[model samples]
Target: MNAKNSIAELARWIDALPNTRRLAGHELHNYRKQFVDGWRIDLNLAENVSINLLITAQFPFVSPKIALIDRTKFLSWPHVEKDGCLCVFPPNTNVDPYRPVEVAKSLVAETEALLQCLLDGNLDDDFNREFDSYWLLSSDDLRHQFFSILPDGCDSQKVAVWSSSKFRIIGADEKSVLCWLKNRLQKDYDRTDTGFLVKLSKPLSPEEYPDCTEALLALISEDAPNFLESISDHIAKSFQPLTIILAISATNGTNYGVVELCRLLRANEKVSKCGRSNRVSVNGFRDGKAPLSVQLSQQTKYTKVVRSPLERADAEWALGGRGHDPRFAVLQKQRVAIVGLGSFGSFLTDNLIQAGLGQVAMFDGDLMRWENTGRHLLGGDTVGQNKTDALKRRFETNYPTIVSCESNPVDWQQRIETAESLDGFDLVISTTGSWKAECMLNDLHECSGKRTPIVYAWLEPFAAAGHAVAIMERSGCLQCGFTGAGQFSRRVFDWPAAPTTMVSQAGCGNEFQPYGITDSLHSIAMAVDLSVECLLGQLTASTHRVWINKDRKIDPIQRGWSVAWQTVPNFDTREEVVSEFPWSARPDCQRCS
Candidate 1:
């Protein structure tokens, strides 16, 4: 729409509204005049209410911004923001620039419905229904809060300090974060009692709350003469400091939770300073019965307690912090061992760490090399360094929640053979890509009464397929999936009997598949999925899963798919779901025979 036509149409709509007028000659949020067209809305009712509309130059194309003149007088809710702007239009409304007529009409109807809601007492119900949302979105409070987690039904006056403060904080850091941890163990409190130290944000000042005596006086949302009169009147009726806790959440910038701590300060009773060393003290003298000369003469005090709200983020909360399933919480206590530090192992390990693998023991005997950088999590700069050492530095700096990531540059066979055993681990992941190593680990697991579960994750040549086999007490062992040896080996996803699957790299001992990290990540994904299920106690049976990439572009393409590939039937090629193969015991298998 042209600038001239936009203004003329808006002017026409403004003139047609009931008790409304165009706000001529105004600034549009600091933009030039043509940027916005303002309008004033005055409703004729038993009690008159007014609204301000600031329609953009894109009006009839974009919805106009509407706000109430006095916002605090109304309740906060989903549709009505704390700033009193009404959310009239559902999100993502399509606006045709050619037609401001339709948008103007819809906005008018929304404004009428909003005013009616304000008049009919329907907002009260909406406010209650979305109380938490409104509370989080409310901006009346912004002071940081201190949180104390406690058992339910704890006493307030009891000063269960470290445990419960009757306040919720959306984020919990050490009380010493913004400051130092206070010495709450001084003679002022019992040492036997456990407590958490909370740092105050600089006490609430008397600028907004003048001459405030009791903590309960902080409840007044607006300024008033003697707002603490009710708190003072009820002072004689209480035995403890009326604890009032106000919580401010960083979410929608709202403050919620009100707890008051009020007490009759004893004369000459100096409470220990709520400061760091407990060295200084606050003098107590807020008695209403005291002479007006005494009360007025004293330094006007305001409770500096601004309640910071928390979203109840615990270990389970940490698991879902990155949009992960909360069910991953089941792995919080499980310890895992990743038997390799190469690309497939490291990539798979990262997935496990993010999935709440609380502690991990990384085992790798090789040194990170430049060639491995294309697929390894540790970069090329880490070349020549022990793979395990590189992984330690990477994880400690990047994935701290992985509690314990002890890396040993020593071989897995040595570790399993030495005094330190796998008895302490919940699950062992073998991505060493060595058939000999996988066989040894499988034998150890099957020999030791299957005391611990070990998952073997490996990828096929050309990244065409990957397999994760769970070798446990109830399932088939690794040797059960293979029979024959060398080029004649009949296994899951065998290569076609043609040009050797291995390629020599210009060296005596180096041979590798021409696959990229992106290809390996698919294999890593399959490994972690099964590992998570096993850790969460969901995988009760021994299972073999195969993932075939029908779209994988392999060089030197073979004539036909292997017999093993055609055996697996049920899967979605579009979604790339894995083909599940339940334990099929090899007739001539060495283990689990």
Candidate 2:
């Protein structure tokens, strides 16, 4: 329908509503400049509420914006913006172009429901649930720039703040602050200020929120007089701006608010005499003035504390859990050892790092060549660097949430020769595609008394199929899967028993399997998923997972299919799929016997 019909339909719906009329002339213009039409809803109730529904020029495609026109007394209410706009729907609510009338009707219903909740005192508790929204509403993003690396918790303690003229960063300790600065700014600072962090028993209502340093102290003094005294002492010593992060243990979750107070004066500074030695004097104080601490206590009332936005940049929040996700909490404790950094291993390590693994030990001997850039996680910038070192820099710089990443640029055979080296690891993964290396890792794992599970992953040529086999104590060893040599006992895609599809580049040693980056994602996913399961203690027995790209056309050099392919139902027709099987020992396998 055209814009004309859409506006007319909205008008009809507003006309049908009770106690409503079209807002016209300068009245509508005063509220919204670009609206095609608007309506005023006078909610004839005790509190005398009035709402304005402005239908914008992009109606039908965009929902109408609702404003509470006469809401001066309701500014403190939850979801009520400073501009009197009611957040009836969250941002990015989609509108049906063909059904403009229903859209307006639903918004009207939402606005009514919100007003009812406000009158019933039902939204009073929402102050805690939506505290960040209201707190941020009062913030000036340009002036109050800050980032927080502080771990979210309900404990009140002394935190550290790194402040400069441009911005500030608050963290749990000096080390974390310095580490974050190194990761963000590529530089280190030697100084940090002591900051106060207090956990409130309950979130403050708008009325209880303090606007200045003295009020903040008064608010704290009620329950934590000793903490307030400590904060006063910190202020006396600080020569720069101070930060105090307020955390409320709300019913829903921990809500945060930041208050930054400008420095009143430097505690001590040296003054040069006309022609004599320098003399140190306490700045902003008379020689016989009241003690600096006592004066500071009195000066705080005039010092304004502006509310700043403190974003959580810690690992849990960066991992997308916002600190409450158990899966990430568990993953953050796991230490994984990746034995290779080839194409498959590179992508698998990237996935596991993104999944929030706490620490990783990487072993790869090869340097990244230009040929590996297309599929490797490390880009061309690190072409000459060792894959392990390059990947360590890449992941640590990009994902600072990872606790530690150890890169051993030696051959896996030399680095992990014994099981003792893998003692502290939760899981050991070998994606080397070298059966010899995998055999050694398997033997080492068995020698370690099967304390750490091992997972071996590899991709078939042309990326037509991939496999991830998990080896644990209860299941057969890695040798059980392979009969002899590098060949698996069972194969999904078979070849015509001629020359394989390996291609040679300029040199005799340069041979590579042809595959694109996108084609390897599924295979990477299979290995990372199995590794996560083992880390999370979700897997009970050894598991074998395979992904087949059945859509790939069978080339002339390729045989049709093997018996393993027949196991998947409709294998010939399905485009792409994954299947799982138990990695049980074959009765004739000598390793199991």
Candidate 3:
């Protein structure tokens, strides 16, 4: 229905209610914009409070918004935004377009219920739960200016701070914060200042929240006295702005708040230094500095402070805490080595890194060329760079949750020959699609006593099929799937004329199979799924997974399905599908048996 009709229906519905009325000209004119229109609702509360049912322009598509009119006292309530909107529904709440009146009724009901809870003080405890939301209610442009990487703990201690002209970063230690700074700034930093970290047992309510520098100190002295003592001297004597980081522990998680003491001055102090009236001098003597204990009490009453928002920038918070992805807690401890950074490997590496792996060591000898951009994750920006190096820089810059991203600009074969052992990695993935490299990786697995699982993935010509084979200890060897001549012994499909379709843009030996980027999605997914399964200990035996592009129409003159595929039921009718098969060591295989 049109918006005008919907609003008319809504107005008729609200007219049936006793306490609600359509706002008159003056009040109605204020809300008669293209984006919103609504009637005022006089909530049946003890105090004279009213709310507006704001029917948005997208009316039925988006549920009506509820806004509290008398917002002065309600500002401290949970889920109340700075502009007086009551966030009654959780994020991603769906709306039924056909039931616009019912949707509006439900939202109004939820708002009233929430307001009643506020009246009874039942939601005061929720202040801690929605601490960050309330903390960011300030209109300050510096709300998102500070970032904290401090480790999660209740014990208060000193933290490292890196200050720029507009931004500041707080970290648990010097080395970690410096590393983060280097990664972000792309430069070396040798110096850092100290900040006081104060742990609050509980977050403060809006009324208890501090507004000025003196109020912050009062809060620290009241709740975090022990921490305040440790940093009192540092704050009193600092010539530059001093930082205080609050790690308020809430039931959901820790919420960080940052306040900077921009200036220190006494009641009668002026902007002067090294003079009789200078606060820096001891007892009006220019030669001596004031005592630490007295400086805070006597001269810091009017200290100017900037309250900025604090973001948790550490890997732990980014990977596991924010998204609630439990895999990070386990996968972040495991190390995986990717032996290639081509089209297949590059995307596979990206998937693993985004999954929050702790350490990912990439090895690839090839440099990215313009031809690889269509299928490869590394794009034109890194066309001339080594694949591994370019990917390393890209991943680290993009995925901050990745604790360690190492790149080796050498072939996997050469890396294995030089390294002590491949056993150090939890798993090794080879997506180079080279049989020779796969054989060498198999040897490395054997040399490591099968300590590390290995996954080999490749796409057939035209991407008609893709396969991922996992080699586990005592289960099978890489040769189990292939004959000594590098052809699958139990191939799913056969295309004997596929070799004739190979195209070479650079040279005769540097030929690449023709396939669109979309055709290889299944291949990359298969490899990534198998790799994660192996790392998570979900796969106990060697296995092979194959993805068949059932929609692909083969050239009947030269290509056809293999005999092995024909035996499968409904093989011809099936759409794109992934089939799993057990991989066991072949009895006649010279490598394993």
Candidate 4:
């Protein structure tokens, strides 16, 4: 906090001014006492605008708040805010807060320059110089009649205009206000008779911008040809805030709602206020072809603006810090193949999305049924949709790297059996709990010289337990963990010889292994961790991981819980069943470990 000049120097400087007076017992803003030996003076900065400069205790350390003392006589300008503050300096460019005299002198210099710019009728350049900051005045005033939400990073030359809450923007209209409304607002538009249309711009940059009254109307006239007649009909019929938003695509592909860009102009002696009468006249315009020009009430003051989306995705990302960690950079190049879209696979897919998969390819042949609503990610509304398609759409919308495969794993395996190899994936996951599908994937993984690692997971009947096997390239394949008959390879914990865990949904043919959504979620949780570990190149061995709920078995005669949650002979009586289940792959298996 090295201040450039002291209070005495500032006082000496202020004393030389003509209309200055020392004020005592003063306070600045809501806090603190003002300078006991400070000057309050008025300076004639411009011909019409006068400046009242007050030197508080904070003085040069903090820039003085400047305002035009007698502003009624001066014309409204882009550099002049409603409060008479001049846009003389850049936003938030406090070089040295502690340097009092330096800051004070700089403020005065900028104010002087701003006054010159205003007098020269060149204030519009100031607005364009800091366009984002100038818009702050109207950003908080939310009374605008029309709005649009544009997607970020889209290369669009389109529009979405709403009239009477219905998007009548179609064909030639879409090029107007092109984008908004989140999910809920979008649902409202869907229930109505609104439609979107694209209206392309030819070398489109607003010619006389910040002067929306002229530029926007001209744009509408140039594009639609009959837009002004329609606007004149509506203005004649109503006194309500008649807003017609023209959301055009920006050059940089970023989205913003076009609200306005106002530029002040000379007043017309014969002009009438908006909605006064249909038979109207405007200043300096000889033709009635541009009807919007007649709507002007004041001849000297005007403003024009281009609206932009207030809610930006990049802003949210900046605030939330999502997907920004350097640690996750390692996983950015990892490619994954998820082989099922059932309850287990869908939830596993969701976990992958949250954890940030770089490139993913999903394969599933089943359509989502009503029964799947209880445990599926696709939801009840997507009851008849293909599970892979639904999940792929969801991921690609948010993640941008997910691709839909041509077919399911089984069909895809057949097509590429004689090609240059299907081993390009970094990791392949299986969660189908289908023995046939598992066998085919295992066979694919068993092919020699392939480098793709595999992680297979399943929930036992009733979800009383779950298991995951992470097998690396050239390690034991899925076949090594079983005898190809639904039997685990000598599990540390064994199942009942005659298991009766099936529940009938539509008789015996439709019976399924009953499990709650939560139980399935827990299984996927373990599977996700193991898959991530393998992708990070941390896990190398072909091993088995399992979760066991102690009360899974029950007695048929007594209807009591069974303690038959038994493993092999060397079970430690003290260890927790849910945490410790590591079964080793056999060395003499067909698919060599």
Candidate 5:
């Protein structure tokens, strides 16, 4: 048949098939194209192929059958049965058959498998084994039977067709024809070459592995060949020795456990990468037979103590006159308030307390829930206890002399009011996103008589991202820092078009969700660094400052830029300070004006 006539005939056959008819015209066209274009199969072979279809419209469906007429070169079931009748079944068949859709799905899947088998080389031993049972039938008998069963006047020798068959004829050779029979009959072996096999040998054992320090040196030597040979003397001179500490758990016995340490050391008055050391230590109680915990302490001249906030304050004060205390210079008189006492808030409060803040206040309205055991700083026994009260109790227990305030009824709104009640603080930190509370605080700082510095830090859902905004009074408030509004002297507070409700129920709330320990640690580090900088008068008094480290490619250090503040007609005011406590112009604000 001509190409056009063959295509028309194939199109008619496909349209008559119930499964093919259900697919959209475009989808069916694409499906046909996958074989004709992708596989590059010869259309002439369709006329000589006798196709049979068996669809199981049940729980587990099967594919249709296909066979080659006049040529029994490569034939296998369900393409050719024991009696030489073609039978096709689906890819995965259970005891029960489902529906026609399921049967069609099986046909498509099996067809894909057949195509892949053809590509990977048809010397499949399993296919040969499965076809052995039907090998007894003579090739002439198979051809005669196929031609007889075909549609009247349909010359089997001239018709080449494609069908959904588990068995597929791939190629014809002088000796034996290549085909994909059934998965169970095909050999499930990987034909990797010798070179690949050698490379796939077992990995070196831990003890047999090269030392990390040596491996690093070797890598540098190979990667920097040109530089290494030329700078051998300079490299030697650059080498420096430094110490590091490797913390190990008790379960890791000595001798069997390894400790790795790498550090930067001073060389020629500059810090450079020094060599690393690895050692295996055995536990003393294990008779040296079992692995022992290994801990390595790098030797250093300076001794640093991680102390609580009050202790750090006292230490700084005692050493301030001597000029030897970095804390004295960093924490002179820093005041910090933490709003929200859930997992994130509690973690931040504890860290700040340890950082030696002069004064710290924690605020939260919700009580601890049973689900907070893993996230909360409080013990599981403290479940159902007020989060603020529990945090305060934990703080007092750890540091009796430290002065910490716990505000139970003070939600974000009351917290802002409470903050206003206290003496003007240097920095106000808030983790809660209570819109009402944030609005109140923004208004108070914007129009209130007091001009206290405010910093807002929050973690996005799943702790995937964190946002921090440092607002210098009259400089750039949170609303002004938003990308929408450029630098403006007049505060532009745009409320969200739709109200965003934060879930409060224990397990269902988003805000109440606890961040991973690593995220919490990172948040604490950022909060502490910013607060310390503000306390030390290191922060720029710019109108806008945003702290973000989303892209790891960027330096992980605390860095930000300043934007010039522009004057807005209704917002900018050069008045030294508001004369009255409550300004009437911002009366439209739902929070305090």
Candidate 6:
């Protein structure tokens, strides 16, 4: 078939796919148009393949040749000479005449596999290997070479290994596993009613492997009942030291029971104290005054330390505990503002609430529409309710003590007003639909000179998945940080007269479309958890901006991770300006600025 007929056939095939009809149709048409024009086939193909598919197809034998064509575009692979020819050939089989349909099928399958790999978090070792192999391969060579790059091992065995072992190792490490478990517990258990116990066994001597085994058995036997009785068996387990870590569900002062158990173990002389308290505390073996003395408390005798009101006051004064320790209280009392009440924003709000954020201000001018029910947090009963109001109601019901404020009748303008109203808020977060909305919040923070941090969380549907949190302080504002014009800005400037539907495609329409809630929830939890780290001062200035790309599908999944911050000199050496240039400047911006 000629290029036109081939393109027509592919268009029909793409139309048959479930929901890709529109995008495929457009891409196919563009392919034909570019092909018909003088556009180089190689360049077109490189541009056409989505970034997600390109990353996935890194492996030679396992990936596909994704091409971009603009009608009648016909060119041989870059590795092939002037006469159309292929640099690679089929292995173990005769190279029958090449067919376009076969090539298309290979591309689609490779893209699908890449997406699956990304979702399963199984792309690490394969990433660099694929990149090195394909860095010089021509397009046609890529199409054929990928199939030949499969390892010599049996496919079934490889599948089993991937499913069981290698897959688990993708995101598993001591630090990541512990962090994941802590996040899980915070979401699953009530903050005020649960406590965790980390029990350490006696350290084994160099020649005590047998004794260690026996101690392990004994510790497992003692901990089995508690584990089996727990509501969920998904408790994270890690074997490092011979330690038993237990998270006990508590109500009121039931946490004290775990504390007492730790004290009892310490007193028995059978177990040595490794750590203690509601928060983990390192125990020192001896005081500075005694070189060889171990500070041991009396057994079964708990001391109050302070017997009278005056003594209690003095102890509090010494520790600087006026009402609550400022460090702990600050995290527990953060006031977060969710600027958009759309699908992604609503999901983020749910995660922030579940993560024990004390105060949340929801701002949105949109009313709950029927189309929103598919993906929004608020459902049937809230069809016509304001989005912010519905979110506030749900939040208050789940956490009665949580302070929720709804800023209805609020657009980007009113958002500024709402932000100004907040007194001593630690952070301002934006998930608004409009880039202008994000810019407004950025401007608000700059104008206030309050040094309050700002975080912008969002997900780009299908193509990219992750939220970008910018801690707007010393780091540049959102607009300044944007490397290129986003799709929305492009649509506004490239085709100012485009219809609303076209503009919507480049804007908020896809965000409202349905997706797996689990993935959405996972991304939101990551963003919120990182925000908590920022609030607690766990993240350094060098590691503040985080990008959680949910779309990574290579062998080693590179989900959103932190990017180090650049160094800034001390402010004393530079002249300080109070003018609104930082707040109001929109130089070279077509969107928010």
For TM-score, the strongest prediction is 3
Predicted candidate 5 versus true structure: per-residue lDDT over 66-92, tens digit per residue: 322223333322233343333334334
Against the true structure, what is every candidate's RMSD? 9.1, 4.5, 3.9, 12.8, 28.2, 25.5
Provide the lowest-lDDT 10-residue window in model 4: 502-511
lDDT of 4 by residue, 151-246 (tens): 333332333344453332221233322212221122234322122222335423222333444555566666655555554443323233333433
Mind giving the per-residue lDDT tens digits that candidate 6 earns over 475-587? 44555544343332211122234344433332243543335554455546655766676677665441222222333343122223112111111111111111111222236
Error of 3 at 434 (Å): 1.1
Tell me the lDDT of candidate 4: 0.52
lDDT (CA) for every model shown? Answer: 0.57, 0.75, 0.74, 0.52, 0.38, 0.39
User: Which candidate leads the pack in lDDT?
Assistant: 2
Ranking by TM-score: 3, 2, 1, 4, 6, 5
**Weakest 10 consecutive residues, lDDT, candidate 2?**
502-511
Q: Of the pair 1 and 6, which is ahead by lDDT?
A: 1
Q: Find the number of clashing residue pairs for candidate 2.
A: 0
Point out the higher-scoring one by TM-score: 2 or 5: 2
Per-model tally of clashing residue pairs: 27, 0, 0, 46, 35, 27
- With a 3 Å backbone cut-off (N, CA, C), the pairs that clash in candidate 2 are none
TM-score of 1: 0.67
Candidate 5 or 6, higher TM-score?
6
